[model samples]
Target: MSDVEIICDKSFSDVDSEILDRFVEFQQAIIDKDEAKLDEILTEKYELVHMSGKRQTKQEFISEIMDGTLNYYKSEIIDPTILWDDKERATLVADVALTAKVYGINGKWTLDTTVDFEKVDGKWYFTKWDN
Candidate 1:
């Protein structure tokens, strides 16, 4: 039998376009409520550690986006910072703002979030986030 080796070689600093691409796709997914596309981008180990110290799984997170429960007129990332490690992992931190469509629904503002991504088999996947 031949030995099989898996290489995770995608570096984060060089993946600015990939990160931006994911952001664009994420924006489109949110705007269109495309759960499938959103699911594909998030890793199974995804977790959102909120500013208030709440943790949510990828499924739960996607559910919020898909169910219109967290109806955001516009959710955007601003002033992003990205870092990569030798373990084939990446991190992104950015400020975010979420505006609601209707009144009485106050929008949200948050400082930079810390997101961890793993480059598994060369494809980057969001694994964890903390604000």
Candidate 2:
């Protein structure tokens, strides 16, 4: 019955904004079905774990998108919380509503997801995502 308290570093705002921007760009890439844009957003070692517990490498995920096995219609991110462990690494957790088709099955889903990012060469790239 007590109120909960949430705290994060104040200096994270700028970095969090940049990371959030990248996340939005990532979602847009899916909606646009732009493989090149996706490639640009993900790190070379990127991996994704779907809500169904399916795991994919960066190339596999991109291929699925390119071949229409996975199609994204919309994505809405809500209440994203970002934590920076250091200058080079951070984690973002968010509630997301997604409208999509996976392997020909169409559905809308709401999921709590986490994405890990790493800063390399002055840019943030997604390294891992789990939903």
Candidate 3:
């Protein structure tokens, strides 16, 4: 076989780092129950799929949070990996331990989570998440 060269380019750039930082902020917003900040960080089309196969739309989710129906006390993300499909779309996968009260049940859960983000108007917003 002839000599061949292969290039592997999977390194995260500064922009990607910034996006990851924003994601961490997003997690914090949930823990802090900051409705306004969550509003800014989540896209209008955001959706969440719970581990129990329940789904919530953006407004429904936000309303639950605002009403204290779904409260997040804390979240610790471990070994996050980010993959950008293009300039506008990215996926972040990580193992996370989260403490929360949902639907009147309070518990701590460790889960493997996949979060999707989209870039709109030069800003990144969380579009969806599932575990």
TM-score winner: 2
Cα-lDDT of candidate 2:
0.85
Show pairs that collide, candidate 3. none
Model 2 per-residue lDDT tens digits across residues 25-66: 888888888889999999889999999899999999999999
Model 3 C-alpha lDDT per residue in residues 1-131, reported as the tens digit of each score: 21111122355578877777787787777767788999899888899998998999888888998899988887777667788899899998877777889889999887778999998898889999887
Q: Which one wins by TM-score: 1 or 2?
A: 2
Ranking under lDDT, best-scoring first?
Answer: 2, 3, 1
Tell me the lDDT of candidate 3: 0.80
Candidate 3: misplaced stretches above 4 Å? 1-12
TM-score sort, best first = 2, 3, 1
**lDDT for each candidate structure:** 0.65, 0.85, 0.80
Per-candidate TM-score against the hidden true structure: 0.74, 0.89, 0.86
Question: Of the pair 1 and 3, which is ahead by lDDT?
Answer: 3
Checking candidate 1 for backbone clashes, the offending pairs are none
Residue 116 error, candidate 2, Å: 0.3
Off by over 4 Å in 2: 1-12
Which lDDT value does model 3 have at 13?
77
Query: Is 1 or 2 the stronger prediction by lDDT?
Result: 2
By lDDT, who's the top model here? 2
Q: Write the per-residue lDDT of candidate 1 for residues 24-124, one digit (tens) a residue.
A: 56656655677888788888888978666878898987887676665555656666666768557777766766554322456665546677777778777
